[model samples]
Target: MQSLGLDVLFKGTNFLRLLEGLWVSVRISLISVVISILLGLVAGVLMTSKNIVLKAAFRVYLEIVRIMPQMVLLFIVYFGTTRVFGWNLDAEASAVIVFVFWGVAEMGDLVRGALISIPKIQYESAEALGLTKQQTYLYVILPQTVRRLIPLSINLVTRMIKTTSLVLMIGIVEVLKVGQQIIEANRRTSPNAAFGVFAVVFLLYFLICWPVSRLAGYLEKRWAA
Candidate 1:
């Protein structure tokens, strides 16, 4: 059997470079997720409010995000901003902005659904107990909403991590970008370089995401019980 010479991955600092790139992806996803969750929580709670204008504004934001393809959003932020506004945004910053926009919309909708899923009786019961609106949310409604939101939110986290691959189009040197570089460098000498590098990228993503998915399932089952 002809050896595929997968050793190229381990050659010199190749593996370390991949790790550094993976760190960039992870860092962007993590920070964006944090910001998304906070913003989503607020937008979601506001979505359930009785005020038509407030709800209508957030509804439009949600619709825009849902309708726009993330890649298009990335381009608009990274390239369009530079052309139109001369903003001089870096690739990583543009990636963060796009992902945070996507994440906030998705997470907000998830939160809205979770909050609305609670029966009206729950709210009435809180009122019957003479709980203030804030107290009701703090002590009763939010806890249940959180349990419902957790599993879905974790899934979003995985989605954001995977989607960070799109950042490469704007020249962020994340894992996929690193893999491309490795494959290009070895294109002549190692015919199997693309296969080997992409396989490693697949495994790295699975290694990062699979645990989060499993935890979501466990929590779902536990909450259901």
Candidate 2:
């Protein structure tokens, strides 16, 4: 263990700190995901409207999100906004804001796709049966949209969790940051601390995301049938 520097994790409270740091990352992602889902639902519905100008605006927004790197977004929200707007946003809060901004666009796009995928025949059939538009959506469209959206949105959660590592760049002290701290603190005694620390960090990430990915897959398979 000393040869490989895995012992660094066993020393003092290093492992516990890593766990706590991971929770920070997870907590931020969870908050962002919830807010993103709520706002994205509204944005998705708006995107589907017949207003050409509205659709065009959403298209531009989506493209901008797709093109902008999350790291850049983090800097803009954490550094630029804090200085420009004088809002005094802390690192963790800034991380959540950037993630929610990014996630909302992704979730909105997924919702738009799911909503549009429903066959027009279903709408026509509901109308033929004397169903009002509201009733048709509540009964026919929403059920299917929820099914499709759930799996996709769950997958997005994993992405957001993994992406929260970027928050460390803004000084959030998340898992990766904790690992780096461990490696640096033990560098003289454990020359290979970096390897073991980062390897364990990777494992921790896998442990969290693997189950979520599997769940998404299971739902997608079960609901597709």
Candidate 3:
């Protein structure tokens, strides 16, 4: 039995195909992140609303999202919901839906924390200056909230990207799924190829995630400064 060895990941066709899978994962993550950010901002704002009813409703939603494991969320979206509701969501779409739900909950909580962290005195001062409510949020509260939110939200983006790999369980042809396919296909000729293939998959995930992590670190530093 022969194996491609450690070098298989870097070979021509294999490398290109792996990169293609990476791009597909990246695309799904990006779309989910954008949608999540928008939803999170709205939810976060709702969380802080003075109206008791709105706050209570958003609180319940956040609690449910925080309590659920992402894999189970994926399973519910891809399997359970389809069976129960007759909703025929494709795997990729289901993955996006699940991650967006998770990301929004996480991001909303971060935003809530950051918003509440702002000094109460700051609001009083804005009111003292005769600033309108809209002006106060636009010029005062939002800028500061954004600075705090950036690092935390960036971390959430990285998490979402990593979590997208779980979509493979639903038969989405992600990088890990492709690696599984390759390993199974070549296992007959190259016994014990699974470990090598998985190692390559790990590296590919690392390569993709590392830069975003570094960027998150840089943003944290810059925001701190």
Model 2 agreement with the true structure over 1-225: per-residue lDDT tens digits: 677789999899999999999999889999999999999988887888999999999999999899999999999998899789888898888888888889999999998999999899999999999999999988998789889899989989999999998888888899999999999999999999888899999999999999989999999899887
- Model 1 misplaced regions, further than 4 Å: none
Flag the better candidate by TM-score, 2 or 3: 2
Candidate 2 versus truth, CA RMSD in Å, comes to: 1.3
Q: What lDDT does each candidate get?
A: 0.90, 0.91, 0.82
- Which of the two, 1 or 2, has more lDDT? 2
What's each prediction's clash count? 0, 0, 0
Cα miss at 115, model 2 (Å)? 1.0
Q: Candidate 2 has which clashing residue pairs, if any?
A: none
Candidates sorted on lDDT, descending = 2, 1, 3
Task: Give each model a TM-score.
Answer: 0.95, 0.95, 0.89
Clashing pairs in 3: none
Off by over 4 Å in 3: 1-4, 7-12
Per-residue lDDT over 1-225 for candidate 1, one digit per residue giving the tens place of the 0 to 100 score: 124546679878999999898999999999999999999888789888889998888889988998998999999999999999999998888999998898888888988999999999999999999999999998999899999999999999999999999898898899989988988888888877777888888889999999999999999999995
Error of 3 at 190 (Å): 2.2
What lDDT does model 1 reach? 0.90
